[model samples]
Target: MSKYVLIGSKGCGSVVIELAMLKAGAEFELEEIPYLEPGPDRDRLLELNPLGQVPTLIMPDGDVMTESAAIILHLADAFPDAKLAPATSDRQRPAFLRWLIYLVSEIYPTSTFSDDPARWQLPKDAQDGYKRTVDQYRKTLWGHVEDVADTPCFLGNDFSAIDLYIAVMRNWRPGRKEFSQSFPKLTEIADNIANDPMFSGVLKRNFDT
Candidate 1:
């Protein structure tokens, strides 16, 4: 109860929060749930979060916090010295909020729906087309970000959690290779995060694949 407890899976959305907490020097323990397949751990996840999602955080006061954006924002607020996000009054704050919400609300759902077409009640025959279409749509979203992205970071010189978000998210669905080819600027940001001493180890461990 002295520190937060994060429930998540490897290479999943939780990696962003894990990196954020690490960057913040927060004391927390990670509980890995085997979300890729069904088992006891997943059952535990269901009990904690009805949606059975990863990155469900249990606060020190026994409160439950879900959603990656909220958790990362909380960490940023809790440990401003970590510089994981821009301050509320900072000029970059609007851009930070814009993209963070965009990642979770827009691009993230494509992966969620595509992960299991059955969940959305799409016909089995239509599933492939659904996944393909969403996958392409996701790239379009990334391209929008790419158009505005800057070197070594998303918002120009200052690095924020958005960079970490990009670094991790680009590795999903269409994957790193396609990501590099289509969005070179964002790829540079990802590469910067991957090479950063503070964030690199967690990225490698979570995304060893």
Candidate 2:
């Protein structure tokens, strides 16, 4: 693709995908708009992403894609030079994909809920319901993380795209750091991946933007 335009938002898993694309040195352009507010840009993003969300990628030929996990995988699989994915010979593809899906499908959506009445809909009265829902989903996602705790890097020793996806997805908790600090391994990995140069500017671009 001549240009890879990325439609992303703050505190979203899309940041990881964009970071991976940047790390891979893939030849593509980034198109991200944070702050869920909309104008012409939001409308354009909706044209590509029916959900009206971020992590949308537009190819040079007008092909549009949504979903952060898929975006990261597509970039790595398409570019061998990037080496964001594992080798075909490796047998961890199954586990790698599992966590990738977990982050995208399970954890990413949980952030949309809020205990704060200022953030979500319903009413000041329904804030507790929203929080309860968020907790259930968050716990489920963490359980998935524990289930596959045996594997490092999600797909073995290598740092695949899944690692990047999870790191960004988990940043949503805000207080998640203090809470998940109990999980030593995950906390360590989070810190390690967060420290990578590939992700150095990603937090700023994706979260601070």
Q: Write down the lDDT of every candidate, Cα atoms only.
A: 0.89, 0.68
Worst 10 residues of 2 by lDDT: 174-183
Best by TM-score: 1
lDDT (0-100) at residue 109 of candidate 2?
Answer: 64
lDDT of 2 by residue, 1-209 (tens): 67777777666656776778777786666665753676888888777778887777787677987777667677777876766776667687677776767766776667654535456556777777777778666866676686566445655567777667656655566455543664555655665677777676776555552
Instruction: Candidate 1: count the clashes.
Output: 0
TM-scores of all predicted structures: 0.95, 0.83
What's each prediction's clash count?
Answer: 0, 1
Clashing pairs in 1: none
- Residue 86 accuracy (lDDT) in model 2: 67
Runs of candidate 1 with Cα error greater than 4 angstroms are none
